[model samples]
Target chain A: MINRIRHILLLYLRETSFVLLFWVLVLGVLFAHFLFTDLDFHQWLVRYITTTQYPVFSIWSSVMLGAGIWITCLLGWMFKVQYAHPRSSLLPHYRSSHLMVGWICYLLIVIGAIWVIHVGGSFYQDTSDKQFAFFVAAVFFSAFNLILGYISWPTFAVVLWGMLCLFSNYEYFILTQILGEFLTNVFVLILTSSALLLLTWRLFHLKEEHWEYPYLFSWTRTSQRQHDALLTTLLDMVEKRLPSHQKHKPLKILRWDVLRFSIYKTILFFSAIILPFYLLYIKALSEYFLSFYQSPFKYFLLCAYSVIVIFGFHLRSISLWGRELLFPMERKRFIKEKGMNLLIQIYLLWLFLFILIILLPYMLLMPEFLMTAKFWSEILLTACFPLAGFGALTSLRDLSPRQSAFAFLGIVTITIFQMMQIKNLDVPILLMESFAWLFIGVLLIKMSYHKWCQTEF
Target chain B: MKNDIIDVKNVTKCFGSKKVLDDLSFQVGQGSVFGLLGKNGSGKTTLIKSILGLVRPQHGNITTLGDDPWCFQESTKEKIGYVPQMDSLYPWLRIKEMVEYTASFYSRWNSNLVNELIEDWGLNPQDRIGTLSVGESQKVSIILSLGHEPELLVFDEPVASLDPFARRQFLKTLIEIITRRPCTIFFSTHITSDLERITDHVALLHQGKIMFCGELDELKTRGNLNLEEIFLEMTR
Candidate 1:
């Protein structure tokens, strides 16, 4: 059983890098927290017992428990594979009994680790004035052990045990305030041991019984053909869009349009208009604004400006002209056609934003906050340049729907930085916005020309 | 005399360490119905995919209509029509919309023939492809494949999901189409009876290799037994 378990573990290690990476990340987090954080480790445990925020705690606990269940399930899966298809090449064949013994050994190591962490945390807490370093170490080790144990057990059992432990600790703290810490530690140990015993019994029953292995590994030939066909179609699509013989300039233009029009519309809308409005709403609801700011309307206007600038960038990005490849046209013709389409989309979006801005003063009941005609002209100029730059950036990135999530994050981060930088400028906000817009426009035109020159299709 | 439409030579494919198709070689002549017979895991589909240029083989060459299937040039692609084992039509598209959309891809699309097939298959032009039953979907797939008036047709397990009556009707339609056009029809199926009725040439594949490839009557005469018995004997 020990040998079998070792073989299974060895096979698992060979098969998956996810488990190794998971452990590495977990250990790294623990090490960092212990070395850097000023958090009181023992007090943190007490807080877990007393906390009433069940929703947050329950989610965290379930995540920990789910990891443990997956690990146990993986072991069962490996064992079944070995039993069904024994490797003749594996030297010094191990008995199933040896595997059972190995499982028990693994369980003991896990239980022992958990017991040590719990005992160490409790001991340090009882002896007040313990060094911060020692306390941190104890907490870190405890957290690591708890995580490992949770992953080692069945999913449901781990969840049940975690809930039981939390409630039992709470009850013990309430019933016996003086000896609560020690009693809780003892209870955790007892529960862990009992759960391990129950798991062992279950494993034994599973071993003795002739269980039907789920045929999860079987691949239907028809399904395989369909998958292959899809890949082939995708390859064909890609090849058609980016032909080998085409020059870089025209190909880039075509690629830009394709990326823009296909599945990027929703992303553009959210990043530009929707996201800015949400930020404005958040600012209005904030206590800082409510207490100090005289005009909530000004904040709304500012948000609207930010939205316009951000929307310009997104619009440019979405319209980078990649989609013209789908139609049967020469690279030069495709580039020209797509460029026209993009220009039209840009014009429409700008028109929509202009109309919205014009109506904002009346709808929002803050005519004074509205930009002056001169300010509007300056803002449009600044917005146009940056929007063009944003379009160029999007084309350069060749963004896909899968990468849109990360792109939105990048947009938000950039918007925050730009907004902060522009606020401190001595020049009028409108003028600054215009300059930014113009800069982006020049970049877009230059990039668009460069793309048309470089692309080969 | 050189009537071959598909000629695969020394074809090999592997997924990880397991070789799914090992040095496979075969040919399907023009104007003849070819049956590729294989068990559940045999490399029939892999061979079909390689022929269609869906999968690039690790080693060897496949020529379909005297051109690389992977090229998918307008002229090369126009010569062949394929009905995949599963329906590949966009489920959201209505029958008429799908036909029109597919028709756009081919220069030689026959709208009249497509309309005829739609009526023959009892398919409603306005119904979504997703709403169709398995047999109905197969009929739509067949209609789509035939709409382009290709010189060669490739179908993988065309009647695997069809009812007996539907299967018979599908075969009858297939036979009539092949007879009218004199196009090479390459179809893969597990059912030997279907092959026996319509197929002029047969290739029996077992464990990633062709057990036999010849005229169906020749194979029957050589073994002095029926095709089903011969298949079972060869596979075993």
Candidate 2:
């Protein structure tokens, strides 16, 4: 039985090695940040916890822990495991008894690693008293809910998650305060244990039929409606997220009404204006701004912000132009038409940003807190071209997702650096930057046209 | 020009180091029901895709309906109907919606024929495509391809998933449609018995090359072997 459990655990770990490695990398970064820099994630977390009341530490910590548990458990559940009846094995009760063992092994490693880092230290004891006991109970429920979620209705897990977060947030809850914290946990433990006993019975009572529930731990649609619903959600997401225009449109190469690309452009264009005001609503955002405002990372943050805008602008264009090349008819005409559409979308997006920047002072009703006309001109010229230019420069095959993202960052960084070196938002320097971007954008567009003409699917 | 509906000439398509179609050449004339027989990975699908202009061969010319297969115009596309080996139908839409969406693309769409066929197939138009079984989805794909009443129909393993009843009905439907109007039909299939029933011209594909290309009766008379035996012998 022990060897079977170990074998199952090893098999699962091997299958999900990439996901486990990604999680390990994230944890490694957090640990390294603590070790290398003065910034201790734990200490910072401790500070964040102390600031909020009602055992703010306990509730928030549980929410964080619950999210982690949910993520890991959800990843485990995504993989559908098959049950093989090993004739020689001692564990002969359930067809998927090994799966239960695998889940146990999974929870142990993930939760145990988190405990060693977060709760193992003296800092956890120093942070809050109520947190330690509250967290232990929260994690137990989270694990029980997510795994059992697949076997039963998935909504049961969602409800359990909601209950955990909701109950933890309330300071005046009668159950927690009157029943005492340890007693409340004891009640949940009994509740979970009873549920587990029911689950064990269900697991053991296996049938040769029920193709959907091939394994005891497997997730399957109870009805045709459930299957359709799952598939609809998946297909809708794939359709929406596929980087082409909404409709196939006319046989013409360059029509403008691609719904998907237009949606992002409209959102990004509006957000450039609306996001600043929305930031004002969140008091923490302004405080966050001030923190960066005083820090050395301020310039780096600004560059990142610009890169995000440029990246967002070109992201869909890569798909739009890439898809157009795959069409059976019209080579040159499609290129010319698609190029025009690309320019129009970029120009329109920039126009929205320009209008927002211009109207901001009047909307805020501030006279002294105003920018020069040079600033508006600078915004109009520089913002429109670089993103589209860089987008046109890269092909679907030439650069990977990581490469394009880094390239966008690189472009923004260089543009900012050049502007900073000049130390002026003067007309000539702005115009030079504008011309450079325009020239590059047009040149890249032409280069892409050539590549599109030649490349095959 | 030579009364050929499909003219694949000296087509050599390679994927990286391996050649999928090695100087493969074949033609299907108008009013001929041609069956392409091949083993798995014998480039039957690749050859079909190349003829449809979905795939472009590196070194050769393929002409479909007097137009370049690689750059098939709108008019040329209107005349061709294709059913792929695996139908990639969107699951979010209902059967009615899927039919309508496919119908919208073709200028020569036969809505009456499509509706009649859908009804005959016993498929509920209101049912979402995602709720369909594999055989049902294949039926939807066939209806989509046939709705245009295309002059040249191409199918890659069109009835691989159908049950015995559905397969009989499907083959009956194809025969009924073809009898109504003379059309060029080219399809690849593993079912040799079905091929013998439907096709007049049979082509055997082996190792990216055509080992046999002629009338089914001619091969049966000359070789004195059934299609399954012929296919096995050719592939082996």
Candidate 3:
């Protein structure tokens, strides 16, 4: 039994090695900071726990939430592969054993998290008081719900949970005074957690046979293929609904590019509609929270979102490169057309961002506050970094790991600079920085175009 | 020969330290069904891709239809049709939609031929490609390739996933196309029976080089055995 449990643990670790490596790198950086600076591990924990200020509280909480969600999704993926397969039919008893092992593994993770909190609290007992305890309990319960929800119905869980998150009043809910009197009691936490666990076990026992989960973990090799199958099915459905506009589009490549662009634009339209509502909801939560929103963190998120969308578009292009190139068009013409199409997409996205994030909010809710030049400059600055990234689409194949790291570092430095400039609000300096980025962006785009023209495939 | 549809001159290709194709050369005369036979991982797809200009060889040169395949012009591309070993048709698009998308690239598109193939193959124009079975998808791929009615057709293990009935139907279609027009066909496959039925000329690839390049009848006479036996013996 011990050997089997050990083997399962090893398998889980191997499967989640990428996420684990990310955590390791983050912890390593923290450790290095502690080594060089005056503040120790205990000091940092105290600061994190006690500092309920704007950026620190928001950044730490968001990072922790993101990490928890990522881990839950990965666990959901593993559970599907392990308990929900044809092989489980042959070895029925294995299901019970697997369930037992899975419970033990999960308990081990929870215990590990508790141990860290306990160690951190040992240095300063006040840090582990009611608020911190409630935070820990919330993390555990939410993780359980997320993983189970994801395992049961992926698209439903993702979309519904994502929508629910938009309406959440973080400041209103996380008031230490309000939460301290509520379900922050240790006894209540234990009872509720046990009940949820029991319910999960019963559900698993009853529907083990009929459990069908979508493969959402596209980073993993096996799951990537399954996810692709699911994507194709969804794409097929979407393709039927979209009009081809084939009459005006005489060129074949143009029609193809236009179809892809339409799909992308449609998604952006939905997001644009959702964004203003979400921002309004957040605004109503608290004026303090609104100030938190204006921080460099929002721009960082913008940059990240742009990178993700562009990366997805690039993946589609590269995957179809072979098939598309077989057509009669010159390689240069093909790439040039695709690049131009992508540029239109980027501009449309930027326009939507400007309208939804800037213009709409100012016109409707907070007219005078959002009209500041600093806010406008920050938005423009956000566009510059991602636009630079867009240029590297053609040169992505040639980008070495070192160059990528340097580029990431450069973005991080710019974000830090933007954070500092938030208080100062110097228009000349901001515009100068933006133009520098724009110049670099244009240069990279030209270089990539030249490189792509010379490339054989 | 100057009139040859595809001419290869000592093509060599390598990936890192491993050589996939080594000093290979062959020529296919116009209006001939040339079959390429090789064992699994014997660089059959690589060689086909090289001929199509999808892949570059480390050494030597290849000319298709009197132009270098590496820089094939639009005019040259218009004359070529290819069915890859793996069907890469967009699963998002329907048979009719995919056909339309592909047809737009060429000046001459035979919509009648596409519609006929779709109907004969028992595929609906409205059916999503993702919902289709492997054999059904392969049929769609074949239909898409043949829609433009190119002068030269290059197929890489095109019948691998096809059912026996579909395979026979495909061969019949191929025969019909050739009989209707003067065309050159180059195909690679492991199935010797299919090759024996259609191909006039044959090339045996072994260890990244052509072991035999001559008439199928001549090879059969020399070996005093069937095509399959000859293939198995040569490859073994």
Clashing pairs in model 2? A246-A259
Fnat of each prediction?
Answer: 0.00, 0.00, 0.00
lDDT of 3 by residue, A1-457 (tens): 4444454454455443334546754885476466547777556654553344555434453444445444555555566555443222212133455566666655655664455345434433344455465455554545564465434434333333332332222432433333354445555567657865764574344322122222322123454444445544555665556677522212333345444433343344346566766666545654554554444454554553445344444554665776878888888777787676566556655665566545665555567756688777777777786677676544665544445545555655555556655556577777777787788879888889978777665
Clashes of each: 44, 1, 0
Question: Distance (Å) between predicted and true CA of A257, model 2?
Answer: 39
* Model 2, span B1-236: residue lDDT tens: 58999998899988769999999788888899999988889999999878876567889899888888654665677687788787756565678877765564455678899999899889999998889999999999889889889888889999899888889998898898789998899999888999988999999988899999999998887577877987897788
- Using TM-score as the measure, the top candidate is 3
Place model 1 in a CAPRI quality band: incorrect
> What are the lDDT figures for the candidates, one per model?
0.56, 0.59, 0.64
- Tell me which of candidates 1 and 2 scores higher on lDDT: 2
Docking class of 2: incorrect
- What local lDDT does model 1 show for residue A443? 69
